[model samples]
Target: MRFALNHIAAPNLSLPDFFTAAGELGVTAVEIRNDLPDVLSAWDPAQVKAEAEEAGVTIVSINALYPFNVWGGDLPARAEAMADYAAACGAKALVMCPLNDGTKVSFDSLVGALAAMKTILDTRGLTGLVEPLGFPISSLRTKAEAIRAIKAAGGEGTYRLMHDTFHHHLAGETEFFPDWTWLVHISGVTDPDVAVDAMLDAHRVLVDDADRLENVAQIRALLDAGYDGPFSFEPFASKVHDAADPKGALKTSMAFVSAQL
Candidate 1:
């Protein structure tokens, strides 16, 4: 299994440092975030691309365009700008997230949004990684639903799904689509009493032996089922940042995941 580093893993680290660490850890691919420090969001696109090239790292994907299904006045422009920036930053894909909160968006709306986004992505030779958030308030809650939307949008060749283990569990989705999946986000939740509806991204953490979410097993199953995409670490838990040695912790986690594979 190949490992890809997520920007959330070391949000405090500078872009150079993050890439350096990733390279040192034998990680060739990385996921950049619009919210992370010293990323394309803050730097010039040319410089960001140069820096990534100098660091010898390939950007796997952009973290996300949140509530992407809710296309409105500025949203279409913003999504287009983000897609351009992602392309300039040497990113292969843009992660598109679904709508959340109380607002109701029909599957038809999602299909429309995805079709529009696909046009933008295709123009720039980029792939759209459609991620279905499993939160109760989220409009898109399952990989199956995402697949359906992709088909409805006629995005079979332009878009791919992101199978996030945490969201998969929260959505209670048991189906897997290895062939259509572009990447897999791996993070475990340890809280036992946490309700699925209440599960937040902040609870994401490194996979541990006692993790209740079965992240390792799920990843193993994905691989066994013929998933050849990068398995990215996307822990949002604050403990990782507070650790005495975050890189050391990451190395340990990598070892654990390697053993599981």
Candidate 2:
């Protein structure tokens, strides 16, 4: 299992401490974020690159540029800024998320957005990991839809899918796109009372015996289908963020998931 950690796993930690935690967990790959802890605002790209080098950890990605499927407004500018920051920080990719406000964005708009973003990504030698948010209100909710848009935009080499297990369940998608996927975000929802559609980021937590998201099964399926990539932890619950020992909790969860496989 190639395990990676997102800074959301411990939003309280500073970038230096986050990299140390990843090393302690025996993981060489990690994903940083522009939200939550917001490492981008706290440190310069040179500092990020230097710290990552000192820690001997790879900055797999910057967590995201949101509402990226809407090609206009400040999105074009934001995308370039993010891509520039990602390149400067030595991050390998930039995660791109679509509009999740329950509004309809046309297919033409989606493809157009990808085509525009591809240029920004291509110029910086970065891969855009297009992640579909599976919220019922989300404009894009499945890997299949993302792939179709990517292909329509002629973004075959410049883009890849972010196969998020939580979103996969929420979207009710039965098909897997292992070949098109380059990264996987894993988290669990342990609240048994909440209906599937009602689950949100607040409900996400570390994977455990009580997890209802079928993370283990999802991981097995992806791996068996030849998706050789890192499964990065991305829990967004307040409880996880407030944990006194986030690394310890993550280690336990990692052990549980590994044992299951």
Candidate 3:
């Protein structure tokens, strides 16, 4: 299993410390975030590149440019800027997520957005990782829909799906598209009081017996279908971020997931 760490795994860590922590956990690949404080704001791409190189960590992808399917306002500018940073930092890809506000975005619009982003990505030699959000309000909700949009936009090679376990469950999707998947975001939702439809990102935590999102089953299916790319930890719960020993807790969860496989 190729396990990677997202900056959300330890939101409090400095960039250098996050790289060091991922290295210490025996993982060479990591995902950085712009949402996390001082993670991307304080450093230029050159500094990030140098620090990550010194830490022996590879920045797999930037964990995302949001509302990527909605091409309005400053979205185009933001997309280009993120791609520039990713290319400069030696990151292989940029995770692109859709609108989560419940308002519907038409299929044609989705395809158009993808097609437009494809040009930017190709120019920068970066892959656009299209990740469908699964909230009730989310415009895009399934890997199938993302695949359709990608193919429709002629983005088969330029774009790939981010098969997120938590979102996969929330989307109530059963089919798997392993070949089109570029990255897998894994997190377990263990809140018993929350209904499946009511599960929020805040409910996402580490993998364990209490997990309600079926992380193990989803991962098994992906691996069994020959998807050998990295599965990055992406817990969004504040409890995980505030853990006293984030690395130790993460290692235990990683071990549990590994043993299941």
Candidate 4:
């Protein structure tokens, strides 16, 4: 039950402050993001590396390279740039998300994209954490599909799955790939009125007794199946973002999840 924090959990906090908060919670691993707080746009890679060291926290990953299944049109350049930044900042991995606009990308394209990105990640000694989006419109909506693409691309050594609890529920995934997973993103959706098909990032909130996403079950299953990794908090709700004491809220949620488990 290793816990970690995602920058999205407290986008308002400065990078150093976020690190400090995680430290207060006895968490030393964290995921930073290029969006939300957009640390990449605001801080130099060397600065980010130095700050993480100063805070005594490890930068587990950079949130992602989006629509990664689309291989052309500057995607390669962007992928290289992100991998370089990740290496420079001492992050271990880069999260890769597929296209989610209902535009279907061929299976060959998915494999080709992964193969191309593998070279970049390998050269930098970084892992590509492929996360399949679960929205109805997502081009790659299942970890099984992602696994096939990774195997086809011969990227098993350079890529791993990012099992996001929210996406897992939305994708209606019944199987767990613990051996292939290196990270897990956990959030809860508690809106009683919102249908499962209608759930969005705005509905994501900290886990509690009212959580409807079965986060505990998902985690227990993963652990039982031999997954030993971090469970990062990634609530995207505005209510969470605007919290007056984000760290306190996160701490409370952390306790609740731990108690339930």
Q: Global lDDT of each model? A: 0.86, 0.94, 0.91, 0.95
Pick the lDDT winner: 4
Q: Write the per-residue lDDT of candidate 1 for residues 1-261, one digit (tens) a residue.
A: 999999888888878888888999888899998875437567777777887898899998987888889877788998988889988889999999887886789988898898888889999999999999898888899999888889998999999999999999999998889999989998888888887778898888888776777788888888889999998889888887566676787888889878876
> Model 3, range 88-183, lDDT digits (tens) per residue?
989999999899988899999999999999999999999999999888899999989999889999998899889999999999999999999989
Q: Cα lDDT for residue 144, model 4?
A: 99
Model 2 pairs whose backbones collide: none
Once fitted onto the true fold, the runs of candidate 4 whose alpha carbons sit more than 4 angstroms away are none
**lDDT agreement of model 1 with the native:** 0.86
Q: Estimate the overall C-alpha local distance difference test score of candidate 4.
A: 0.95
Q: Considering summed lDDT, which 10 consecutive residues are worst modelled in model 3?
A: 34-43
User: After TM-score superposition, what is the CA distance of residue 156 in candidate 4 from its true location, in Å?
Assistant: 0.8
Lowest summed lDDT across 10 adjacent residues in model 4 is found at 33-42
Between prediction 2 and prediction 3, the one with superior lDDT is 2
- In candidate 3, stretches whose alpha carbon ends up further than 4 angstroms from where it belongs are none
Show pairs that collide, candidate 3.
102-137
lDDT of 4 by residue, 1-261 (tens): 999999999999999999999999999999999899898889999999999999999999998899899999998998999999999999999999999888999999999999999999999999999999898999999999999999999999999999999999999999999999999999999999999888999999999999999999999999999999999999999999999999999999999999988
| Clash list (residue pairs), candidate 4 | none
